[model samples]
Target: MNTQDAGPLLEIRRLTTRFQTQNGALNAADDVSLMVGKAETVGVVGESGCGKSVTSLSVLRLVPSPGKIEAGSILFDGEDLLSKTSRQMEGIRGKDISMIFQEPMTSLNPVYTVGKQVAEALLVHNPALGRKRARDQAIEMFGHVGISEPKSRFDTYPHQLSGGLRQRAMIAMALICRPKLLIADEPTTALDVTIEAQILRLMKKLQNETGTSILLISHNLSVIAETCDRVYVMYSGRIVEESDVFDLFDRTLHPYTSGLLASIPRKNSAIEPGKPLHSIPGGVPDMTRLPCGCKFAPRCEEVMEICCREEPTLADAGGGHCVRCWKFLGRKAVKV
Candidate 1:
């Protein structure tokens, strides 16, 4: 095992997952690869239904039974997670790699008290721990995640807490055992701005303190830019672009990445106030019936003849950047 001292904490290589739907087989994620180094944070950002959530779920082999990982591997600490059995994965989930879902209200057990729920997580991984010791550990972890009066909050039910507190509770539950890596899928979606900032800061601090790698998935481009060191932009089911945070925003190679950055609101823009937000100009093509060539070509502003004819491979484009587009191919001099 590579562990946290050296190399990547979690390495996902050419991971693909598809569902055999009634309509046809739907490709949720196709040949996606990325790395999360020890104590590093990598954000995966894309529009909804762009396979952001599915990629993270695939990391833990959590994708539904109907869907299958047809290719690639999830290498966690140099151990291929995809090769692990169900019982083996269960042991790893809370102990080595924990995940925090989007909605706390729905994700947290409604019937169990907050403390009891987190305590259960501790107990699950450590069968030797009795209920009282588990309860103490849960309270300590909850406090570590910034919950106020952890003792009192522990006994309260999930429904009794505010949305922000509930999210904190989720983080506490996920981090109770100090897992080596954490996957947060839009963890701040339901919280207000202040709470969002607090949670982000808290997670960052914990990452620094504990050296936990993070795989953060969100549609919020701004959050991705701020929190992540490297980013992977997904379109349709494939990774269309990957670059460092600054390169992504300053010198984006892919047209899809450019559009996403340009779509962010500006304080003093030249365009009229009523102008519509610049969407990609088309719905994401159905995965089951994706276009033959570059999946994003249908919505691309700089469409080319080759785009519809062949799927472009993710190729090195320069200075630590990779992009999949026919535009990168130098055109032959036209007979003018």
Candidate 2:
């Protein structure tokens, strides 16, 4: 498939998700906009609490209680999903688009057998299939995910499986129906490096075979670099920079993105003894009480006076790269 010629499979425009807090309504997702082209892989990279996972959940209209999609549109195949009814979304969710949630233990049912969960996903989307066929297909999926003795594992409960096996089962459940889009939230988290590589490779291979677009959410820049075509750097619930993966690594424009890239430990690179690993100073801003101006201004090394008084909008910085910093917005950064 020619990705260049294909239109976007999913487009999110000005999406804002909010949660009710004791203090007030906290904007978990603040006017976030992004797209995933057909047969393309887009990565949403950020530290914890940046709303990467919330953005994914909001796409599926599955935001947890106390939180709701307060504004904006989620366009899937050019249709607005925000306008869809819950019943309609039910048909959309595991059929047209599927999600592999962050954790398998919490996402998968403890009482049901692993095979049953996989079979249920298939059955929900393709309800005409018989139980026997669903069972057989579940076994097949388990095998495809590299689970040993698929037939035996099919009857085992979630607690009986190891973390890697459980995660594999979650992947199997997510992909069994071959949806057009896959929203994978931290798919390889908590796994060993070897298993993490295997899972990423499996997702890539499956995407190639099925021509499915992927929205990969991760905090690991290295994973995003390896698996994504385009990348969006999110900070404090807003996109700070977006570009092609190679361009993002080569010429990252946002200070937050630069800090994140600097923190990555380089392999085979000479390091001075007694020096500590690089870390971005400060912490993620509290969503309930975010700053009035640039949310990252407090911690940014290149912070300017205007950054503390004005919020910057994401603007194109040539060659499809967009940045939301004053330095890229035709304003010179002043020394603090």
Candidate 3:
């Protein structure tokens, strides 16, 4: 269903998350806004340390010490998460919303068997579930995620499983409760191409089966292209551009989004032997002390005088395609 016809499953409006650093307070997520429709797979794409992970963590109120949600609201199914108590969050975390963290090896417990780890959510959320029932359900989930010999693998530790298997175990754990929304933070970062494709396909299939909305966070544009229905392009902790998947590729706006799209390597496209691949110029700004204007002004090729003087807000260009750029704000490009 289209977004207009049905309300969003998760709506984050101007959510700002800050961290207390040596330099001072850093805005890890600055007035970030996005939404995930029912059963929709939305993606957040950007370079490393661009607040993709922080945005997801803030939704679940999982931001660690030294970091705080400074402003705005996170609305999930019409309820404001920021208003919920920590004890109330425990009931919502695994049952209604779940997260598949970046690294399975580190996210999974080495001390516990995979079965115990996977079943923990079920046992915690549903106290009526007995140990044997939880174990059986966990094994079933392992099979669903394509683990070999699911029964035997249930007893295995995270170290005992292969990289792909460990990832599958993590997926099983995340999906065990059949959550309404799944926030996957670079779920396929460490896997091989073949395994990555398989995992993506499996996630899509499960999403179809369970009608679970997904908020996928990754730096890989290709991965986002392969799965997401809509995309948000983030840079320096703020959303720069957002559009449907096809519009993003076909009619990309914002210099930063264009730069990201241009950097993707195309196997079929001819490449000159000595020519270097295109990369976005300059580096991400310091979060503790970001520039007064656009965060990407230093790297933006089509940057104008206004870009360095006045920060642009996300304005709709048409068809729900929004961009945060001075060019979209009717300013003429002035090359320095």
Candidate 4:
């Protein structure tokens, strides 16, 4: 796909995914909308349980049982994915859209050789390749992803490889088919800092080689800043801010975004010695009993009466940077 194309490769519109629990239905992803242009890396970032992972799962129609996509349209290559049947979606998953789940140790089948698992992915999508050819391709992919001694590693089981190698094998499986889009959900979560850096670099390198759009889900703002071309800041199952990566760091609008940036430790900062790091005051709200109006109002430092009474829409502030906060909406902040 040409990067210059104006249309996005994956466009999600007004997505609302809900999960049925004993209490009631809770919105895991509420009215979410985002896009990934061809060859562009878009990030969905927030703390855990903020619905970043649910949003990605919705894109692949893999929200898990009991969680239903109540309303939304996921358009991939100008085709609506929600409208496709299960069999059709299966065909598209590995061949058109692939995912690297958060934990490789849990995601990879424990009983099978890591190489065989990767090879199985290719064969599932293209069975005509035959086992021998699939194994050959899988080994080639292992080498491509920087795994040492691909031939020797082919017969090694998942438990035998280190965390980094397991992750690389997962990546190779996801990219073996060269899908149009890759959904990486916390791809580097369990690795050391050095391995994390290598994985991030490898993804970028592979993107350049394959021209695959990536929808990267991560809780770490630093990772998003390094890997994403554009970013969507999610909170309480909804997107509060969307902007170019550079603009997001330079001119943050939402208070939540501000809080998140403040929490990142700065290397060159002149803070007093032994000063503790800054952290957001409160935890994520309970989804089933979310606070009325602005879901983030209770935690927002600049909370207004209007924010507590009415939810703010995601509106453009200026220059295509969108924010969902009363402070940026030109509304007067009445004291509580």
The top-ranked prediction according to lDDT is 4
Better of 1 and 4 by TM-score: 4
Off by over 4 Å in 1: 1-4, 267-272, 331-336
- Preferred candidate (lDDT higher): 1 or 2: 2
For candidate 1, the 10 contiguous residues with the lowest summed lDDT are 327-336
Q: Candidates ranked by TM-score, best first? A: 4, 3, 2, 1
Estimated TM-score for each candidate: 0.94, 0.94, 0.95, 0.95
Worst lDDT 10-window in candidate 2: 327-336
Clashing pairs in 3: none
lDDT of each: 0.87, 0.90, 0.90, 0.91
Q: How do the residues 4-25 of candidate 2 rate in per-residue lDDT, one tens digit apiece?
A: 4445889999999999989888
User: For candidate 1, lDDT tens digit of each residue in 161-274?
Assistant: 998899999999889888999999999977887999999999999999998889899888878887999999999888999988998888787889888888877667776878
Clashing residue pairs, candidate 2?
none
Quality of model 3 by C-alpha lDDT:
0.90
Question: Tens-digit lDDT track for model 3 on 287-320?
Answer: 8878878889988898778788889988888998
Q: What C-alpha lDDT, on a 0 to 100 scale, does residue 323 get in candidate 4?
A: 93
lDDT, ranked from best to worst: 4, 3, 2, 1
Number of clashes in every candidate structure? 0, 0, 0, 0
Give the alpha carbon lDDT tens digit for every residue of 1-336 in model 4: 223355889999999999999987799999999999999999989989999988999998999889999998998988899999999999999889999987997568999998899999999989899999999999999999999999999999999989999999999989999999999999998889899999999999999999999999999998999999999999999999999999999999999999899888778988678988788888999999999889999998888888898899998867778999888775533433
